[model samples]
Target: MDFEELYQDIVLDHSRRPRNFGELAEAQFHAHGDNPNCGDEVTVHLKLGANDAIDALTFTGNGCSICMASASLMTLKMKHKSRAESGELIHAFHDMLTAEQESEPDKRLGDLRVFQSVRRFPQRVKCATLPWHALEEALGKPAGGEVSFSEDTAG
Candidate 1:
């Protein structure tokens, strides 16, 4: 199959059977994000281990295929990564989708790069990113332990 087809299949697979698609009983951080325009909502749960590495990551929510697939891919990519590394990757992923010049996807993004085509659809962009925004919020408020992101106020 062609690369485009392969990418689509991968996304479909993840969306249909998302990995890490639940809550963490031992979560150290948690955050929720929603896109009011599309009604996509996601919550990220994190548990940090030694050296600030992600011991576990999971999510729970309902949204479009793009949103679900992105959340699944994000859990797989961020697992075992240090908080610092995950932070950089989060920025890189956002840049990949929002860059004005349509640049190459960062190698660090792994299969998460499959969503590059999402940039073409502005609305889909928010769908794919809602999970990441929640992850960012989770990572940022370590002390608070919980946070929320509403696209209405994100501007």
Candidate 2:
């Protein structure tokens, strides 16, 4: 199949039946993020393991296919990753989605790579990146135990 077909398949499959969807009963950290412009929102939950690895991760949300699918893919990609590693991957993902010129998404993203198309639609960038930012905020609020950020997409 071609790239469009592959992208569509992955996006549809993930959005329809996202992996790691719903909530984590033992989540050590949690955060809610929203994109008011498009009304996309997600709540991310995760558990930190012995060495700061994300032993469990999940999310609950209502968003566009891109947002929901990206969140689903993120849980799969982020599981077993150290906090620092997760941070790095988050940065890389945002970069990949927002890059100014067309280029291949990092192979490490696997199926998530199909999101490179998001670059062409700046508004959707917030939808795609919302979960990652929520994850970061969730992880960052170690003391608070929970965090939230409604993206100010207005420029």
Candidate 3:
């Protein structure tokens, strides 16, 4: 199959069998995010090391295939990474998902290139970004502003 087809398959497989689709029993940080447009919601849990590295990560949510799959993939990628590194990964992935110029590629995104197509669908952008936003919140960063989606949004 072609690259597009392979990417679709990967997304679907991850959605159907998400690798880190649950809460960590002893998480050091936690946060929630919601895509109000689609009602896709996710709660992310992170276990951090003394040095602020991610020792483990997990998530629980209900959303489209893209959202769930993206979260699963993000958890896998974040393991053993420092908060700073994970933040960089989040930026790289965001650039890959939203970049307009294919010529100026985000090399750090790696296999996350599969999400490059998501930029075309404005409504779906939130689905692809919910996890990263939640991660930021968990790290005590101000994601955007004091904007609230639902009281259901929490860490």
All candidates: CA RMSD (Å):
2.6, 2.3, 5.0
Candidate 3 runs further than 4 Å off? 1-7, 100-104, 141-155
Give the per-residue lDDT of model 2 (tens digit) for 1-155: 34363358788889999999998999989999988888899999989988988999999989988899899999999999998888888878988977666676677777777787777666677888999999989888866488877898663
- TM-scores, all models, native as reference: 0.92, 0.91, 0.82
TM for candidate 1 is: 0.92
- Encode model 3's per-residue lDDT on 1-155: one tens digit a residue: 34364359879989999998887888866787887656898888877787878888899989998888888888888889987888888888877766666544466666666777776666677788888878767766434222223323321
Clashes of each: 0, 0, 0
Per-residue error (Å), model 3, residue 112: 1.6
Off by over 4 Å in 2: 1-7
Q: Tens-digit lDDT track for model 1 on 81-141?
A: 9988998999999999998889988999988888888876765788888899999899888
Best by TM-score: 1
